[model samples]
Target: MEIRKSRMADLPEILKLYEEARAFMQETGNGTQWGTSYPPVEQVETDIREEKSYVCEEDGRLAGVFYFSEGPDPDYAEIYEGSWMGSGDYDVMHRVAAPGRVKGAGSFCIRWCAEHSRRDLRIDTHRNNLPMQHVLEKNGFTRCGIIYLANGEERLAFEFLPKDI
Candidate 1:
């Protein structure tokens, strides 16, 4: 699969991806993370507008979508249990959703981000998101600690730094 910036025109398909992911979570006994209206459409739109939304495509069809941006994340300002890996600017990833047709999509995105990223990279997932935790671990992200979101929800934070650095 190849990754690229998402466009406003891709909203319909991107939303479908999230729906599918939510269903998968429900079937796997991990439904509460996204709940009923987790990723609001407006949020995704804003990510696209900010050029932070990325889509993974396979054979010309969208396989997944995710939010990846580099900057200060106030929600991550403090760590409850662990600490961040780097002190400088860091890239944060969120709202990763994918369809089953494209296996390893998350790993692909992680590699893409790490390859293009010049500094630290971070991601957070719900406690029950074993699949995502595995993806991050397999991709070399170290479990730093827990962090709270703007909504005051806790998430397991992980970070990845280029080995050469």
Candidate 2:
């Protein structure tokens, strides 16, 4: 699989992938994480416009999508119960979703982000998202702590440092 910035042309397919991922999460007992309509269309469009959206392609087709960017991410500023693994500049990965048909696609996206960022990386997931927690662990992301979104919803935080490689 290959990873690249998303194009406007990929919108329809990318939205479908997110839908499938939402269903997959529901099936895996993680429905509340995304609720419904998480990562709304407008947000996705904004991500694309800002060049922060990316897609993973397999056989020339989009297999997964995510939002990644350099951060001083405000949402990650205050961690509780634990602390980030490293300080200074880091990149963040968010809204990672795949159709679940392609094995390793999610892991690939996470590792690709880490490899390309060349800096410490941070990510978070709903506490109930066991599959994502497993994938994160598989990709070398250490459980950091908890973070609260702007709305005050808590999420489990994880981080991967360059030296972890």
TM-score of model number 2: 0.98
Q: Model 2, 3-22: lDDT tens per residue?
A: 99998999999999999999
Specify the highest-lDDT model's number: 2
Q: In candidate 2, how many Å is residue 2 off? A: 0.5
Cα-based TM-score, every candidate? 0.95, 0.98
Residue-level lDDT for 83 in candidate 2:
100
Q: Which digits, one per residue and each the tens of the lDDT, describe model 1 over residues 27-146?
A: 877788998676999998999999999999999999889998886788788887879878888888889887585888878887888887878988888999888888889888999999
Question: Taking the candidates one at a time, how many backbone clashes does each contain?
Answer: 0, 0
Predicted candidate 1, C-alpha RMSD: 1.3
**Cα lDDT, all candidates:** 0.86, 0.93
lDDT of 2 at 120: 94
Quote the lDDT for 14 in model 1.
93
What does the lDDT read for residue 95 in candidate 1?
A: 92
Highest TM-score among the candidates is held by which one? 2
